[model samples]
Target: MISKLRFNTVVGKKVLMAVTGLAMVVFLIGHLIGNLQLLWSGAQFNGYAHFLTAQPVVILIELGLLAIFLLHIVDAVVLLQGNYAARPVPYHTKKWGRSKSKRSKKTWASTMMMWTGIAILLFVPFHVWHFKYHNPVASARPDSGQVSPVVVGVGSTGVNTSGAASAPSKEAYDLALQVTKEFKNPFVSGIYILAMILLGLHMYHAISSALTSVGANHPRYQTLIIWGGRIFTVVIAGGFLLIPALILSGLIDPAKTLATAQAANNQVAQVPMGVGK
Candidate 1:
């Protein structure tokens, strides 16, 4: 029926909002899996980052994601405004609980979805800048096949190591190094952790409402939907939360390790051509 749903109708807008939210949830899970590559090794993680960053498909996907996010936020704001305008002036806040048990109305997480959504929305840009666009150590050319099996440094910067390896491959920066440095700082890690907590809260309420908005709710399976919301929120939010926590705890010391990599590169550069042979 959505094929016939009109944008002017509340159900249509809600449906759009729900679909967008779920899309982002899938994106987050996929992203988390990719990010976990950092635990494997710098090359493994950086290569993955490089692969995604240089791809046209990834860029298009990112643009699509941006559109979805904007739609979701705008739709939500409009819906909230409509609900507000429809409520009787005196009953706007005081009587909203009349249809529900007092405890339901008092539930903070459900009521604070708007605030939590806003918080997560604001946090995303900071995250992008800190770990994506501004990455000091991610090789951008690996995905494009600019380099072969291994990229050697071009002078002081390059993603490969040929005759002279230098500066962690200038083209491809080491994301492991960048993120490790960022997360090691308490201010950065603290904000990250706090945002993840808020994200969990937002998802807890958002997912449940999203399920209902898309007509996935039926008395027979309502309990499953509720528990699914909780599982999704906890796994996604908790997974991301663990990353910064590990970095802050010094478990993911990519900065130091990167330096060691550079040191190794330098050492190899100085070796006599036939000495090892």
Candidate 2:
């Protein structure tokens, strides 16, 4: 009977989903923390971005992240197909019995996570293309107005240096500023806000599910996982959503942030090599 069950055939797929999901969650936490630097001031946010993107370690992390993202998508598609194949017969009746029916009911986060996952999967490549692949200056161009390119340079400690060119067109600093500014459009901003909400909902379910998948669930630890999931969801989602809102409200200045980052880069460039010689 055990041999007939063919359990091993599907174990690899299950393991893939669990491991990839866990990696994604860890990445989300780090991403959210970096974003929260926006609250400190424009300089703080830009510096944080600069620091993150400048590191060799971060570059390696990003490559690993890309791999995990692809793995998750591949696993999801495979599992979905397998599930469809396993349930080839359609249910003939609506009644699944009271107990089973009740069990089917799920929280909004739990119910919508699959859809949210799909949305995020769609959104990510577009996001990377817009920011990471495009020219930062072109990407940051005001949709309907003309403003002189403002170049803000960093001093010894986050101060602007003189004679620096306008911020580069393809840097992360420029891309982030552009994103905040672009959301001034109500339609665009609304969609971004909704996407963030969906992300939050996805995290709410994914976090707890990951814990269970990893065999971490227990009577004593179950409640802890649930509460932790909710908090993680809210913090990450809320923080990201706040960025566009703040930009729309004119509370955050992307241009200024970009300027600071550029200046910081310049300062580092200006450091004379072999000064002791």
Candidate 3:
């Protein structure tokens, strides 16, 4: 069954794509919720980021998400190649050409899926590196628009179940500081907005397509599925867009509740490298 579900057969490949696409949609919804927290407070957003990175469970979840993304993209490329091979040339050249061009103009969302996917693929690695892997050094002086961070260690200050002091815990990175720096960049913000719009376009068509491919085709529910696709695109993409928009617009202040560069560095200076986790 597993072997049959690989990429050899067209039906199997479509099913796989539908499954993976839906998985990504779930991730997008969760990510959007996390990011929307940025609108409330820097500490909240930073704390959320710290929560994701400081726990092993979150790391495992991240790994699983990465695998899902890889599978989706790889499978999509294979399917695309198979489609091109199966129809090397239009059987009815003039007739097919006119209709294809008309369809392209009419359904821009569907037509641009492959191109938008490629654009998003190119942007994600840099985004993850900038926001996740790299951190601003605490010693450097950040301008009003720029920011950096240092990880802070948790102390034995928590009240235990028996009303005793709990043991000291691990350190957590200052993610808000890092995010503020990245989002404050006009160039980066611009590109991110563009990529997200592209992502929305990709999702708009993808949602309905996945539903159809997966055989969610009851006439009574078809309209709902189609509308659901649109709603998902707007909600997920618009939710994700809010963070950068707030930062760029100066609504989310990096220095308001988030850690300052000097403060971050000072907190982590005594702790050894990699001890924050």
Give the number of the best model, judged by TM-score: 1
- Number of clashing residue pairs, candidate 1: 16
lDDT of 2 by residue, 1-277 (tens): 6766543446656666778988887887788787777655555665565555434476578789999999888877877888889989978875535456653425777767679999999878866675555423222222213332321212324322111232333112233444555677777677778888888888888887777776788889887887888897898889889977887777876656545436555433333322201
Model 2: how far is 249 from its true place, Å?
2.8
lDDT of 3 by residue, 2-73 (tens): 865565689888888899889988888888888777677656765565455434476578788899899989
TM-score of candidate 2 versus the correct structure, residues matched by position = 0.71
lDDT of candidate 3 vs native? 0.66
Model 1: weakest 10-residue lDDT segment is 148-157
In angstroms, how far off is 172's CA in candidate 3?
6.0
Q: Go through the candidates in order and give the clash count of each.
A: 16, 7, 0
Q: Rate the local accuracy (lDDT) of all candidates.
A: 0.70, 0.63, 0.66
Q: Residues 202-250, candidate 1: write the lDDT tens digits.
A: 8888787889989999889877887889898899999989888988997
Write down the RMSD of candidate 1 (Cα, Å).
Answer: 6.9
Give each model a TM-score: 0.78, 0.71, 0.75
Q: Lowest-lDDT window of 10 residues in candidate 2?
A: 161-170
* Model 1 alpha-carbon drift over 4 Å, by segment: 1-5, 92-106, 136-168, 255-259, 264-277
